[model samples]
Target: MSTIDNTFEAQSSAGVSGPATRGSIIARLERLPANAMLVRARILIGLATFFDGFDVIAIAATLPILIGKWHLTPWDVALLIGASSVGQLIGAFLFPWYAERHGRVKAIALSSGVIGVTSIACGFAPSFAVFFALRIVQGIGLGGELPVAATYINEICRAHGRGRFVLLYEIVFPVGLLASNALGAWIVPRFGWEAMYFIGGVPLILFFVLRKLVPESPRWLAERGRMSEAADAVHAFERTAKTALPPMGDPASFESMVARHPKRKMSDLFGKAYWKRSAAVAMLWMTCGVIQYGLSTWLPTIYRTVYHAPLQLALNLAVAASVLGVLGSLLCAMLVDKVGRKPIINWSFMLCALSLALAGVFHDASVYVVAMCCAFALGWLACGFITAYVYTPELYPTSIRAFGCGVGGAWLKLAAIFAPTLVSKTMIGGNLDVAFYLLAVVPFLAALVVQFLGIETKGKVLEQLEA
Candidate 1:
């Protein structure tokens, strides 16, 4: 039918010593039964991402109030947001080593527990320093969850449908934002800003469920030559699938199965052959972090200040826009498998950039159109990174995939650390248009880099993508 369908039918295998065929992956997954296990995996990971999205963006929506309450200068507000990014940067680098050692599912579970505890702590912190401290801890959890989720999905997903699966996983981030924004709008007026964190801490519920339900990545076991354990894991999955009454592929005997190819080192990804890709994806993620956090976080503030929307109205709009943003994540999930990751990202970034430019320059547009366009821009821009979330894992092998996603993500958080101040300064200096224009420029550079250096990862399996 379609390219994606054809690819799914073919089952592309990149790491197992053969050419990637698009049909094989879909066929493999088809053997598994339809049941609660897969659903649980998606929901658990998605819920974590949802909390992350909320944690990442909540500051923006809450900032104006914090400013008023604490007598905050722009610089102080920037520092508050930057602190979390710094934690994310550190966590991104460190989590890979831990995930490599401990396993992806375990890392995620630990991060979830960390986020949950830290989030509740943040809610009760009586001072700015304590609040900021909790954010750093919260960020560690956020940063670790991502690479772990990527590795987990990559390990379990069928090759042909992997892109879509990853995209779906990525959707949780935006969905989390939607939930947070809505909750903040409702809770902030009733219970004060701190209550949002109490609500955000609800993800702790996921932690207990995760420990009981989520399985360790079988592929990780295979790579480590723990074949018996790997086979046991797969057998557990197949048995679970069979009980659910779905067709499944024959479970390969662990003893008969060959181990993964020789371990690919983290350093290899930065060498000549892959350096170009590393740069492109890194820059793409960096640019996305700058633009996304800068805009989405500030939208409610802008509405309150420039448009003179009431605080309640501004918060409502932010919450509404955040909900609408899920469309972008869903769009990426739908199209990334078929059209290819590069084109979607290239075009999505371009559209996002253009919309931001228009929003900034056309100060006199009808309010309804401005609302529609801003929502559209946020949705489009949000998708660019969502695609990257799925695309990044595909660029490196299983041995180093966690590392690759981690490093790329570290740059993104680093970019985000600076963007809040950059946007604030530009807006405060009466050059808001300039900020939008600058944002537009970064994506163009990002698109050019991708055109020249990006890799196509539509149908390939995780291990096959490695050098």
Candidate 2:
């Protein structure tokens, strides 16, 4: 079979029962289990994303230390930060295609290894130029991690528990952020900035673990005409997961698999029924990027500038506040399916707006008051988008899901590029109130956009969603 033909037909009999081209995929989803293999997959991806979050935040956390150690100027610091962001931009735009063309499991493994090695190298860099270059490389690795993880989970996770499962992955980000901040606090004081890099490199060790354990995504395999191998993977999943998975049919010829699944191109995302949904996901993710990244990158800076706290004190506060963010994400995972996407998002944002507004009031308030407001805002901000990470894949049909998710989420990395720059420049320029006030607008806008364009997928099947 031609590679293109193989691509569409590559599902393991165990992974999915239908041809990729027709019928609802969700009906097939019911057969998969909430088994150990499924939890392992989610944990593996969550841990990887946790590291991605850790690496990104670790760089920021160590900046104060880097400034003192390296004697960097303001411009140098900006360049250092910008380098990683630029690399993330390139990776987010291009990595999905690589995964689609090469393989999802391979792409995920490579991205993880790259982040690990680059993180280690970042610690030992002899100069700012080299350090910035390594940061860019690490960014590329981190950037690829999320989309690949999302695609992996989307293919393997059963329809019933998929929403909570994916949100669990999202919850890992704040968990990672808290880890990074905790590391920064412990090591930056005792061991200095390089310690963060050393710790960040640990996930590289998981590369071998992943290589041995992480199977090729069965859905991708079935779509690609490698049915037998895919089927083997499914059996392995059932064994390890302890789930009563569906049995695979007789191994199909590659030609027959293609005749079943059919390849979907990126351009399919623009089709009549899908474009609006795509646009909604794009906006929602972008808004998520603006608020989440904006606040995270700037929290320490805010504490330092407004509260006149020491850098150590500010980072400590940011670390504590990050824990609140994690708690909020966990809450989202708990409530999202029950509350429904729109309501959780709407309520999260309304609370976020109020929190941000409260934070704005504390621009000059007492230290305890300021900390309380920031903590509340952080909770709302984290939960608001924990829901998005779960909702995006549900928005598209299986044939085009990866594409829909990749494209819809592109705006997030795009927002990351500009939000940090804008927030840092404006807030540090003594317009801190303006920064918080502007952030207050995002949740409202996110709520409005979701209300207008969002569909409730809470307990509905994915097949019905596609129709």
Compare the candidates by lDDT and give the number of the best one.
1
Worst 10 contiguous positions by lDDT, candidate 2:
20-29
> Cα lDDT of model 2 overall?
0.72
TM-score of each: 0.88, 0.87
Q: What is the lDDT of residue 315 in candidate 2?
A: 86
After superposing candidate 2 on the true structure, give the runs of residues whose Cα lies further than 4 Å from its correct spot: 1-29, 73-76, 241-263
Instruction: Write one digit per residue (lDDT tens) for candidate 1, span 1-467.
Output: 76444333332221122222222222234345544567678888778877888878778667778879878776787788887888888888878768888788777877878788888888788888888888888888887788778767766776667778778878888888887788778778788888888777877887777867876776776666554445444444544553543443333322122233455788977886579879987888898788767777877787777678888888888876776679887978898889999999889878887887787676556555556667777888877888888888778766777888898888888898998898789868977767777777877788888878998878865555655
Task: State in Å the error of residue 339, model 1.
Answer: 1.3
Supply candidate 1's per-residue lDDT for 375: 78
Cα-based lDDT for every prediction = 0.74, 0.72
lDDT of 2 by residue, 1-467 (tens): 76434433444334554444222222233456657766777677777888988998886688877777789755566567667777877677567767776677777788889899999999899888889889888888877777777877867776566778788777888889889988787788888788899889977876778857777776666566565555555555655646455653233332343344335567767766667677678778887777766777667656765678888888898888888989999988988777888788788888988888887777677766777787888788788777877788777655566656667557777777677766777655877777788888877787788888778888754544663
Winning candidate number (TM-score): 1
